[model samples]
Target: MTIQIRQFPCRRDNFGVIVHDDAGGPCVSIDAPEEGPIVAVLQREGWHLTHILTTHHHNDHTQANAALKARFGLEIIGPVRERERIPGLDRAVSGGDRIDLSGLEVEVIDTPGHTAGGISYYMPDEKLLFANDALFSLGCGRLFEGDAATMWASLQRLRSLPDDTMLYCGHEYTATNARFAIDVDPGNLLLQERVKEVEALRIEGKATVPVSLGREKRTNPFLRADDPGLAEAIGMAGADPVAVFAALRERRNGY
Candidate 1:
């Protein structure tokens, strides 16, 4: 049995994802940006939603939680730190907690940067990560509720995963992220090549998500703060990795 993933556009730039396990078990919704799109997808696929895994309390991510719960009678799980803010939350989990989605084991990772209580779900058996807004393709989420250092730490934890892990983020901001990455890492051939690909994909009205962790490590500026070439390009050679990361993030905020 193979894990099946379905991704669709929602709202302005948000993405809605559904992950189905192969053993005929629970089907999980990564976020609830909107109800109509998700409900339509579920009906089309004949998949009964058994769980809703929320990354944070952000409205765009959890706005349809209550509706989905009411419609499907599914359990709502979210970050323990943000339990009060997550509507229809049935279970609250923090980092290092293992949640059993039917027979599948989903590891809850506390990723606090995009939001103070942001969480990510990693399915080690499938090498798939539902990162939501904490990390993005060629970019990391804005430091809305935490500092750069805090975000950097969260990224480090995700970076430690196997290079082959498939990262499914929350938005369709890859094109813009690629442009900013190239501006900061001009000397990186990998980054240059990737930007071209991203541009072509966006031109065709395609989604540029579920990117490999290996590709991100090589080209994403947010993930390459420790690289000597990137540090040098940013005129911060030999500086602490976290400081370099902070500088890159600050520059991106203005870009």
Candidate 2:
């Protein structure tokens, strides 16, 4: 059975997502950016809220947790490290844990760069990843709580997933990310093409998410730290991959 995913914008730049299993067993909300939009989507799709899988303790992601829980009596799952922080957290999970959402098996991955206790969920059967703020299209989350090395390690873990994995992130920051990517990797023809595509999409007010892991490997600066060309472009030739990644991240901060 195929998993059905519904992604919609909510709360300025954040995205609200709903994932439903084909067997009609469980319909899960990836995050609750806001109460009204999420509730509206559930009503429109005729999907009953069964679970709320939170990636971190950030307010924008968990702001609607309490309201949704009261409205639908849904199970709230979040990182074990952030159990005390995330609102409405019913089940605390960590890396290597497997959550069974009815018939679906969701693998928990530790991704703690964006936050001290960030987590990502991956469904192997569907090749889908709910990365939250850990990874983004042609970009990555800011190193808010973790250091560059720590974030690099987290990103490497996500990069190890199959190239075909469909990554659904938490925001609509692709246009800005693409701009920074092009500035740093101007010689990359693939990046050039991707920037144009991103520009066109944003012009149409369309979402540029659920990007393929393969495309990110080729075009995302954070994921391309090991590439010799990227290292040279950033004047960090022969530097360690992590160091190159750190340099790019620092540059992006000011970009």
Candidate 3:
């Protein structure tokens, strides 16, 4: 089954993703930051809203959840740990819990770092990962609730996905993240080149999202925190994965 993904930018840099099945049986909205865009996309495609999958309980991610659920009678699914925080959570899930949407089976992946109960939706058949604040293209999310160790481990889970997996993160922070990446890895030719590409995309008012896992592996410092070069840049002597990850995240938070 073919999967269709539509990313809508909302409130500052937040991204709301809309995912649909091939035959259009069930469409799931990921992180409803606003009602208008999500509704417009559903209406435009004539897709039935079956589920609202929330990665975290942040207002920018779940503010429109209640409105959308009421308007479309959509079932809300979120991490069980944050059920009280996210509105309309009909189904509370943790890592490894599977939910079927039409013929698509979405596997839950607990990624608690940006928030206490953040989780990503992985569609193995479509090789799509809705990795909200847990993972971004050029950087990882800030440690709002969980610590660096948790965020580092959370990112490791995303890094373990297939190289060609399509990563649908929860924000449009690629360009700014790329800038920070360049700072972290100045000698990284791939990141230097990507910074230019990202700048061009931003200049043209285009979104730099849904970046491939392979692409991110090659340029994103957060994903390459285990690389020897990356470890050295952070003043560490060896390929100490956690140190690299911590340094990159700390630098990004200040960036």
Candidate 4:
């Protein structure tokens, strides 16, 4: 079965993605940020909506859940930990739960950092990861609800995915993230080259998403907090990985 992915930008910086199984299976939206764009994509693609896989309960992510569910009668699935917060949530799932979207299988990964109940959807067949706000191209999400240790552990789960996995995040903050990355890891050749590429993409008004997990692991400082080189660069050599992660997050808050 061929899975079609349609990704579009909506709201201030949020992304809306739709995953479809073209072999007469289910078509699921990642997060319902708005009704209009999702409806537009459905109309353009001629695909029927079957479900909505929500990553978190943030308003920007779940605001349109009720409207879409009302229109299409979709099965809305979200994090069990925040089921009460998600609008129109039908099924509450946790990390180990596997969802069967027709013949396709979706792995639910708990990633509680940006929010206490944040989760990410990983499709092994497609090598697609709907990370939402947990992970980004050149950075990671801010600690809004969870603490440093929690967020750090959450990132490790994502980091364990295959290197070739394609990541789709919640926002278009790659440009800013690239700048911050360069400032923190000035001597990192991979990051330096990546910053140039990110600049060029932004210069032409293109989205810098769908970044590979391998590239992110090599450059994203938050994901690399345990690396001895990064630890020393930030004056935290030999520090615990969690401590290093905390310091990195603290600096990012100011950046």
Candidate 5:
């Protein structure tokens, strides 16, 4: 059976997600951004909470891990590399490991750059990616602990996913990301169209997440960093893809 998903705003820009097969089946939260909203969604949906799939040790992503575990006694699973930092983490996983949620396996992929221990969960059966801070709609996380080459490799792995895959991220930064993307790839017609849509959505106070991987591949400057045209747009033509990616990430840092 396909998993059902519920996404709602947590503290500030953070978004909390819960997935399950049915109301009676075991439910899993992607990250515990906050305890109150996570509990609110579970209670409102009448879904039985059983586990939490933590993406990283970042406070915005794992701040409620301990509190949620105490409230629900749910299993806390996180990146093995950050075991010492994730509060209440019961299981540590790494790239290539598969975790079970409602009888379906969630493939864990190591995605560093935002943080050295960052990981992303991919539900191949559902074609859903909980990208965390590693990759966003049109932007990505800042280079806090990892270098450009490392983050670029992680991003390439994500880009290799099926074009139809739907992406879900932790924050609501798409509106701003779209703006930066247009500045860097102004000639991209698709980006132009998507930016209009993003602006309208933000004006109405809507979430611009859960975008298609195909859309991101074509329009997101970060994902397109390896494209010669994208590199040329930023005056980095013929530059190594890693160098192009580094320039884009650096520019976004100040955007």
Candidate 6:
């Protein structure tokens, strides 16, 4: 039951992840942003790559899938609807489909706001979520295909996960996200504290992600879209959850 995570740098400050079951032998690469870092980490850790899990069709997330597959012969798992978008599709899965990796069960969630066929991986046993491009620490993904309502529903699905779930989003955008969170919720003491803490981490050249769901609920403006205070901060009426979420996301897009 040993679960490990390795982070790699990718396109224009994005991130790629490696999730491994120490006893399962091969690991799952969350998104193939680049090949060099993935190769280096796999060689260093001696972890076999069993699968490549894609969240969407964005090139930043799927560009290296073919190369990785050619090199390792690993399975590529992506949204069933995105068969044409993603390269080397060994398995096409949809929402609620469960895949077994050795002994661990991974649940696929169809979160389609970021992309038409975006999907997220949730490992309840490890309390880990590979929430690529959809939800960040304090921000949500831009509306590329889906509308605000769809994004809201997608985020609400993520909010229903256990509070302790560790969220691993697809980019190193937490510092900027925290700043935006503060702007949207200046009255949130938790966000205030987190801004300072995250700033310090950035000063030290560290990552501020793998942020807990509990913390996101308490401090993240995107996740707190149901709060009245946040709605007002964005010049909206009380507790319009969808409105608040949409406003926050739009602001972050501009931020």
Per-prediction TM-score, please?
0.98, 0.98, 0.96, 0.98, 0.97, 0.96
Best by lDDT: 4
lDDT string for model 2 (1-255, tens) is: 667899999999999999987787889999889999998988998889999999999999999999999999999999999999999899999999999988889999999988998999999999999998999999999999998888988999999999999999999989999999998999999889989999999999899988899899899999988889999998888999989988989988998
Compare candidates 4 and 5 on TM-score and give the better one: 4
Each candidate structure's count of clashing pairs? 0, 0, 0, 0, 0, 0
Segments of candidate 6 deviating more than 4 angstroms: none
Q: For candidate 4, lDDT tens digit of each residue in 1-255?
A: 888898898888999999998899999999999999999999998988999999999999999999999999999999999999999999999998999989889999999999999999999989999998999988889999999999999999999999999999999999998888888889999999999999998899888989899999999998998999999999999999999999988887888
Q: Which regions in candidate 4 have their CA more than 4 angstroms from the true location?
A: none
Candidate lDDT (C-alpha), each:
0.92, 0.93, 0.86, 0.93, 0.90, 0.86
What tens digits encode model 3's per-residue C-alpha lDDT throughout 2-78? 77888878878888788887675678898889988888888988887888999999898998998988888989999
User: Of the candidates numbered 2 and 6, which has the greater TM-score value?
Assistant: 2
Model 6 scores a TM of 0.96
Candidate 1, run of 10 with poorest lDDT: 19-28
Give the distance in Å from residue 111's predicted Cα in candidate 5 to where it truly belongs: 0.5
Candidate 1 residue runs with Cα over 4 Å from true position:
none
